[model samples]
Target: MSGQGTGRKARLAGSLLPPPGPARMLAVAALVTSLGFGGYTAGSVLFFTRGAGLSTGQVGVGLSLAGLLAVGGNILFGRLADRWGPREITMVVGGLQVVALLLSTVVDSFAMFLPVVCLLGVSEQAGKVCRNALIGGAVDGDDLVRTLAYLRSVLNGGIAVGAMLASIAVRYDTRSAYQILLFAIAGVSLFGYSLYLFVPRTRPAPRLRKKKDFPKAPPSISYVFTGLLCGIVNLGDTVLTVGLPLWVIGQTAAPKPMAAWLHAVNTLLIVLLQVRASRGAKTITGATRLLRLAGWTMAAACPVFWLAHDFPAVWASIALLIGVLLLTASELWNSAAIWGLSFSLAPAEARGAYLGKFSIGTTLREVFGPVLVIGLITGTGGSGWFLLAGLMAFASACAGPVVRKAQRESGVSDGTLARGRSGSG
Candidate 1:
């Protein structure tokens, strides 16, 4: 009976993982990629400042510049992926990333660091666009959103593990330790990039040129609008990461350590529930509904967080925990909706370009989200929470109509949007 119980547990665990194939392979690659980058992200500032002899201001400027450049670079790379084939572009981007990471180790001046970091950012952004295109072409529609959800979960898990591992380097607080960690991260990333070789090549999309080969077609503006709305909704993440910690430490009576615990809980919940949230989101209408739900849930959580400041230590902790739960729900739902809509809304042949264009909103948010969330929550105090709630609600309200309009304009039926996937779950 004990042996049987062990066997049953194994089966159940295996059932929770993606079926063995392209999805599984990609998940493994994503996991490895995240593991390396996670550590690098956690420790990059110290590495640049201490090991590379760059100042904090220089690193910040360099990263900001890299981010801005990557915004346009991602779109260009996505188009190239469509024209030149995703597999080939992805391989090229991967090679660039490995080279940039390795070169970063030898940099001793801001001038040298700036170009290497920019190269890294460009490669990273292009890699994301190409991977999305590859998955769109390789995976069946039934599993497209599910595969994305699974990969996200894997990435979160890997990052958490990598962060924990990097704590050793952080504790050492020496240049050599930082350099070693950077080198190890590069090696791991190269290994992860190699795994992409096993993934089947996605068919290249048609070139954007007209029949006469005069001018290329302009990208769709509708996707840009939808992407912006999705990016605004994603400010929920910024709130969780930035607003909550600040509020807990500055305003709430809850223990400051509660902030870290809340983040851990957020990660854990996402890793466990992201896949389940993605269900029923195959259709555009279904995805829109989920977006609305995310907005409503987040709206509710905002007030709860505001109220946490009024509570004593224990009650404040409880209230904050509940708020995190609600926010996590919002995050999960929003992510699922975005994945479904991004995949469903694109023209199949222009998948890479569309995906890259859709990502512009996210890129803008990364640039602006933290500042906006902090201003809203900390600047206005309690009123700011209600204002944020209203903003999210408004964005959510707009999402459904926007999606419907896009669907109509594109002349894509729910069946066509879902491809072989089931409608409305």
Candidate 2:
């Protein structure tokens, strides 16, 4: 009876925590890393402008420079990961985060902070590639997709927790308040690194092919279309994070704080539904189909957003919530689909490099989206959103053909390896 009780307790504990494995360890690392970055980001503007005594202009310049460095680093470190290994690089990335956050807390000048900002940026991008690549190289098939979804859910959970803590600093609105947030963030970074230390060491993946004999050929046309389709859908980042909130304020009759609430809904939905959504994402065809459908769901949400202005206050709130719900739901599907497709598309040996290139789509969208949103999406109002939605749906339709063509170009006609290995280009 005592032995039975011990077994039951262990089973319960295992269920509550992650099952004992690298996946759980990776999830914990992702949680703490996201927490630190999220908190740092929430308090950052005030930290630089008030606490550190830098002008808004100084802050923007520093950030833009850092972003450029990070963009370059993703591609560079990707190749490096393919060469050296993701595990060692991942450790270095975590260490850099710890050093950068703690150091940034003390810097009082733009000149001093600029380098730190750059370091943080590189750390962020490098960590992203290394972590994803580590998972790609270490895990496979259904377990791969499942783990990816959980890691993402954990990332959002961390951000939510970090943001909640930062809310306290927001209320106090003092340099000390901000400093304390940074201190907490630094501590969280260290915690993440501790989790990183426990991850079982994984071997470096071999290169896809040696380049010594032949000149490197450009990727085929099919690959370009596939990439474009992926990138267009990836623009949901701008839509979910920036466009939706701004649209809520300018276009909808809903209150401003509702925007935050709607985002809460998004985060909550991701936590609840992301893993379920990923169940179908274990293969390329299924993932592609899911992403395609997700686009239409997002499309349907647009007009609901537009029509919210026509209703009275309570009903308008209802319509707006409905729209946000659709959008967030679509986000869940799209995230899972994209994960499977991205994971499967890369060659086994070049998984790191492939994932690195895949990340550039989001980076590119982030760089271009602000202007696109402010100048076009918001400028044209509901009509513009309708147009944007139409384009997304079109992309969804095209995604199937494009992915099929990409599969053909990769020399897979039967779709067996395409589903099983996911090695496209």
> lDDT winner among the candidates?
1
Across 1-425, the per-residue lDDT of candidate 2 in tens digits comes to 99999999986544333455778888888888888878887788888898889998888778767776876787677765655567667877778887888888888998898999889888887788888877775555558877888888888888989888888888898778888888889888888877766766555422334544222221445654555566666666677677878877777667878878888888888876777777777767888888897888888887887787667767878887898788877777788876766666666555566666666655556566655655555788567777878877998999888777766666543323213331221
What lDDT does the true structure give each of the candidates?
0.82, 0.73
Error of 1 at 94 (Å): 1.9
Q: Quote each prediction's TM-score.
A: 0.92, 0.86
* Candidate 2 weakest lDDT stretch, 10 residues: 416-425
Candidate 1 lDDT over 1-425, as tens digits, reads 99999999987556446778988899999999899888987887888998778898898788878878888988888887777677778888988998998898888998899999999888988898898887777688888888889888988989989888888899998888988888889899989888888888775523433434322322456657778888888888989888889999999999999999999999998888888888878888788889889988998999999989899999999999999999999999999988888878777677777788888877777667777888988898667999999988898888888878777766677744533321110
lDDT minimum window of 10 residues, candidate 1: 416-425
- Runs off by more than 4 Å, candidate 1: 53-55, 205-219, 418-425
What clash pairs does model 1 have?
Answer: none
